[model samples]
Target: MSIIGTIYEDVTTDVLGHIGSWQWLVTFISATLMVPSMLNQYEDMFLLEPPREIECDVSASSSVFNTSLCTYSVLNGTKVYKCTTWHVKFLWMIWFKKSWLIFCDHKIKLLSTTIICRLGLVFGCIIFGLIADSFGRKLAISIDVVAELGFRLILTFCDSESWFLLLIFLRSLFASANIYMGIILTCEIASSSWRTLLNAVVSIPRMLSAVCLVPLANVAPNSETFNFIACIFSASLLILLRWTPESPQWLLYNRGIPKAEKTILRAAKING
Candidate 1:
């Protein structure tokens, strides 16, 4: 099948955040961002006609009606009729109407968007591991989520489109810490016998996260609602961080002896 025409994505659930998980967080971050990423493209599926066409000239506006699908238009009519299932490309087109927003809002804040646009790719590096070493992967992931939550909250206030994109970039940064990288880190320290199996489970959440946003998208199904959902997911990810174990390997390598021992003890108590 042509990748371009694909309409829906498969959904699955397998979230795994380890005490020092890196991969899961990276995936989760990307998945979480994916919700808005695609949704941001939803505005263009339809088109419309002016009322004068309906009152005096159906033939004149014939081309406009036939030209688009899932659109909204008036042919000298009082109310607008939105077509069902507007094509998605139009969303990007509409944004350009205010293309100035791209530069005005945080969307193009130079370095930030460049750095953030690749949360999935970038987190594959050693940075997540370092975060795990200094802050405990769990805590580090938690912090990143919190920051993203705030990024979303503040994002709503931005009138500029450019700045909003910038905000999205920053949010992705935090997501990078909690998503795929976090998951990979967890699998690394999980029981070796079950590592691959559990790693597969970790990947599931990344998949599920997309579908989870579906109902959310349907509920309000608007840009504002979608952004709100993004923030909620970020916060939820942060809170769940407590359930994660501190990476024993991370502890052993960086803190040694007692701290590593305490980490194990802490895991027992939490699990118990």
Candidate 2:
């Protein structure tokens, strides 16, 4: 067996011989607290998109304007006037439209921002995966959570489209890291018998987070207020993570058997 595998076996056999309360506690906390982070990250796709139905009014022309087109022709003339304002249906105040002024002409730019933010999910997995292996799962999750919250809060105040897109990209990047590393830590700390069940439990929050957003969006006055409420949830997760224990598997491989043993004992104490 490899070094980590050997250490994992020893810790599971000699120290954490059976599933205990500490394992269950970690599983529940991680699963519950993760919902907010998942919602905050995944909601970007919905929020970045412009409302489906839009109509434009021309100030100087009495022509019938096509809702699909960005510009319209006058009744008796060939002059095409650009739409300066839009009448949007469904969601009237999405931050993407209000803050950036991304009308029909700027649909491409809106799509680009959505694509860029989503790309963070792919990169965050690869990058934070390495960080988890090298540093420790606990540290990796903590750093990502802090970064995610910081970027999200900063994004609320951003006025420029370029800066807003950049913040959303970075926010998504770290938000993914928080979830990825959190799952890793949860699995690493859990016993082999409990691993599959805990993983399933953790995944439930992802679906629930999406459901939760429906109510949140309806209650909040605007997109900025909605974002602020989401950030509050992220902040609460940070606090909960403080009591969470590091993975004995990671400590054994990186910090030697003594440290790993210490962590196991501490968890045992908590379990008792």
Candidate 3:
């Protein structure tokens, strides 16, 4: 896409933010932020420090099922337990050792963050749905932006598994709401003929953001830096919102014809 194409898409996305394209980027970053939490699954399996030579006394155990009866020891008189040194390529699980997955290899812990994220999506939809209905699309998006940024900022400094999980849930909730609200606003505001093109254009950013995650994770020094980057990107949207206008349709329906007409007229003047 050319600079003009990028500008067009961005302008279109902001215009549609009340109804459509802007949320595509929100969804992308939101989903990207949550991905780091699940990195522990890979870390637990592949990134742990290698254990020293192990001496297992299984000769005393006659049953194959009774592995508990077997006694094991480290040849160097040191116990090989949870990993202290991470693979370094993954780079950040060391900060999260107090979390449940750090001490034990539980399958439930592996799935918990993903599961919580889904739960947040469900809750976010329900909550933001009502908010958009009661307030207006622009206000709803503003709230989502703030919530996502604040939670992500907090997530950067978070150490506990519970706090990390909670922040992700909160952040994803806003993410889901932002996507839903943005799509609705776009669909509501754009002409019926132009809707498809707007949606396709916005989706490009979402795909690019998804592809950037691997490099983002690899290049970031730690979870804090990773989250800080997300916060900065999210904060930039606030500046972008200055160019985004309120939805005339929403204004008409909720604030009456006068406000709606004024907004429409202002938009026309800006476009002209």
How far residue 146's Cα lies from its native spot in candidate 2, in Å, is 0.7
RMSD of each: 13.1, 5.2, 10.3
The collision pairs in model 2 are none
Q: Candidate 1's residue-wise lDDT over 67-154, tens digit each? A: 3222345655555444322211111232111112221123235345444455532642246556666666666655666676787677
Q: What is the C-alpha lDDT of each candidate?
A: 0.44, 0.65, 0.51
Q: Model 3's lDDT to the true fold?
A: 0.51
lDDT of 3 by residue, 1-272 (tens): 00122233344435444333333333343333333233322222321232212122333434422222122333445553442222221223332222222223355764676678678878887887887777776676777777767887887666567777787788777765555455565554555456665555545544554555455455555445456766777777676556555555666556466776666555544444
Give me the runs in candidate 2 sitting further than 4 Å from their true place: 1-7, 41-99, 102-105, 209-221
**Worst 10 contiguous positions by lDDT, candidate 1:** 4-13
Give the C-alpha lDDT of model 2.
Answer: 0.65
Among the numbered candidates, top TM-score falls to 2
- The worst-scoring run of ten residues by lDDT in candidate 2 lies at 90-99
| TM-scores of the candidates in the order shown | 0.53, 0.75, 0.64
- Cα RMSD, model 2: 5.2
Q: Give the candidate number with the greatest lDDT.
A: 2
